[model samples]
Target: MTMMSLSWSLVSIANKKQQQIRRFKITIHRLFGFAFLCSISFFLFSPKIPRSPNYHQFADMRNLLGVPNTLNVITNFPFLVVGVLGLILALEGGFFTISSQAEISTWILFYAGILGVAFGSVYYHMKPDNNRVLWDTLPMMVAYSSLFSSLVVERIGQRIGLGCMCALLFAAFTCIVYERIYDDIRLCLMFQLILPLAIAAVAYMYPSNYTHSTYWFSSIGIYLLAKLEAVSDKKLYRANNYVISGHSLEHVCLALIPFLLSVMLICRERKFKRLGDLKDQL
Candidate 1:
């Protein structure tokens, strides 16, 4: 073929490829936009959902070896241990490395939230009231929102991720505060349910720079198991002759999740160079 014809053919192929890439990105953006709008609509239209009257009654109430709610209360200690460990790792820069200061701040917030969960959960299990439940759930929301934001930052872009993290945290706190004032939990429930699904979708859809992405899936699995155990708390207590309960196991599983995530961060490495360095590397 003539050189001019060959050159024209190559340019046409490159343009077509670029168009395809642009279309793909636009499609992804549209999908996310639709999902976001649906979520906001649900929150705005949902009716008030009050706390269940029997929500505070947990299984494993035995004063085992003179400890009240021994299994339930004791299992919660893992959260504190893991939380402290996570904080130490974050402070020591033992987790994954990031070039951005914003990313570092995000990690600190996430670890701090984990630490707060330790105290808040213990307090809630000690007395198990709506008032105390607030403490337990508030910190949990913080951790959830932070983790979601971190995933966003990693999968998406830095500025967009930071913005999302801030927006999500604000939404979470608003739900908690609104619940406290109005005795409604619909928004909180929506946040809890939607965030995980969104995170999972992001994990599946995006390319990760870090290894050990499976740890995110594992954490999600453990979280689902914990929820199942919590739901079956009374039945498990009865089946086990009151020695232990599903709720106790749930606590253990929940604690392990953050620990697993921390290990993932510590073990993971970037698979690619920074965006600006890509041209140099090429």
Candidate 2:
């Protein structure tokens, strides 16, 4: 009887520990959500950020084989490659280890956005001007929105993920429209930065359901590198002796993100499940 009572005491302690851990996780998640809302509120209420007058100007303005901004135009082909391949594998279902329609659908939207990037970016590079810039920015913003939504679906539940996705989609659309009408890119730029930061935050704070989460981390690193390349386009072009520009390299770096995620989908397995544990606790 004494041995049995001691065992019971240990079991009680473990259960209480699990309960405390669960509550702590919930509190942390809520705090992160609140902080995000505050940051977004600041962006919405802040002043307008206008697109630069020289936004169309890109480094490496070479016209090779009758192609204007040849490197820039050619670089977009990587988006088409990964976008199409990712869409195909995602649609086939069996090709990836995905277990639910929700995630599959999110991936479909993400790949679709990537494909749009290919066409929109190509068109914009062919004749970059204020008039054509909308096509370029819109598709990329859509891709970013889809990316953030995909990570939400992975870390959070399906219902909340889907809801956030619709909200984010609407946010992306509104920002683009605002940019076009008011000639302001502030909201759009903020969302771009916010989404990636949120991605890293979620990855760090939330427990992942699937394996290969390191891919997401590495992808974000790739994104930062791409952004740096984009900002230093002229310096990179001069450094490379006019062979290739940083903007072109940026496209390549950005394209690697989707490819990395796609590889994750193909390789990852469902690791742990909370449903059974919760049911047992109840």
Candidate 3:
């Protein structure tokens, strides 16, 4: 065979290998995610035995929305472990597929996990008069920092990375607005929005002509929609603390959609006519 044809054949084989890898990773991710959900479901469905709010006090239904007692510190182990696995899978997705952008998914999951841990440490384990457990929640900040680093620093040289970071910043802002409107605002909102946007803008200011402006624009749009959903969680429940409506499913779906798409962008087989040919275009 001619060298050109031989090269094409090798490329074909490599493409197939990458696809198999992507499929395997995606399957693992899904299965682990299912297990995580199932664990939560099992805990939720278990009979509620009333007792002191120390060992399993926070295990009851009232604590599902947030931490109620120190038991959460113990109960959170299953979720924390599952979340760690999910984070690994997501990091692989980021490496393997632009369409998947596992960092995005990882951030969402990481956020949830850290939040659970933090809420539990702050509300359950800590003393009402003496505050010491507050420091235990620092993982939340670390997780956020890592997320921005992946999008802004790790993906900096590449066009797609820039686009993804831009979109994420926009989404973060949208979340801030939504939370503010819903009256569920937290001091963390300002830090989440401003710090990331500042970093992304500085990163983008360096002049360069790229083929994939669409990725940035599209990401921004998607992020706006997603943030709207995330912030809407503020309005999801009622005064009684019961989840009567507007639960977190929308936010999860929105976040997951971009994440999965970003993964596909990286790992899927397709024509490379132009950068824009890929939906992740980032």
Candidate 4:
């Protein structure tokens, strides 16, 4: 908590480590650019991955109380609750240690996307077909876009993060259009995998201005676990004696990401100045 104190740890890293950090800073942009180009090129040139023909089928299709896919449909109710509460807190302001309006705006978009997901997912589960897939998919994509953008705002800065948010939003729409025109959800799937990894990597590389960085890791871990649950839907359903489907549990698990993030916001404080900000001050 000492600002610019002559602490041994602050000025005492070996010369080789400093050299490595300097080299990393110098090549960071080019590294990201190359990775971006390679990812796009690979996806564009690769064989198209068509939406599985049986994608609409769910392990739990129980018509409970006149609702089809009842568990999956109802599980999204938590998103509604969490989304509304998070949105309100983000807008109400003064609760989080957010630095700028741009950061707040990104969070607002994040929660708004979650709210959209709640409704869209319910509608999609009602029929579970390509015809209704966009409603479910696009909202979650938007949520992922903004969630990552908000993290960027925290670690990098507001201006660049806002730009990234806009770009990601455009990409989200592109994923939908590509799916419609080419019948390939590969880009969308790739994005879902990429964003969490991006968040984890970025959070590790960038100096945060706040405490509780572990919360970011926790959220990412939960996201991966949700993906695992989704993939094991039938096994989980049978394992639990048909009480809950993995896909439904996935929804519940994903809901915890935002909840944990909200808790992080409330609990974290400005524990250190970003080194970049310090450099600028100098």
Write candidate 4's Cα lDDT for 71-119 as tens digits.
9999999999999999999999988777779889999999999999999
Clashes of 4: 0
- State candidate 2's TM-score: 0.83
Q: lDDT score, residue 168, model 4?
A: 90
lDDT of 2 by residue, 1-282 (tens): 655765676687557645645654685478568857876787778876677868888888899999999999999999999999999998999998787788888888999999999999999999998778878887787787777777767776566667768988898899888888998887777778777887787778676768888998999899999999999999999998988999999999999999999999999988753445544754
Cα-based TM-score, every candidate? 0.82, 0.83, 0.34, 0.85
Question: Where in model 3 is the C-alpha error above 4 Å?
Answer: 1-82, 90-137, 155-189, 199-234, 238-282
lDDT of 1 by residue, 187-219 (tens): 788788878877787777666767889999999
Best by TM-score: 4
lDDT of each: 0.79, 0.83, 0.42, 0.85
Model 2 poorest ten-residue lDDT run = 273-282
Each model's number of backbone clashes? Answer: 0, 0, 16, 0
Model 1: residues with Cα > 4 Å off, grouped in runs: 1-47, 274-282
Among these predicted structures, which one has the highest lDDT?
Answer: 4
Better of 2 and 3 by lDDT: 2
Model 1, global lDDT: 0.79
What are the per-model C-alpha RMSD values against the true structure?
5.5, 5.4, 17.0, 4.8
RMSD versus native structure for model 3 = 17.0
Which is superior by TM-score, 2 or 4?
4
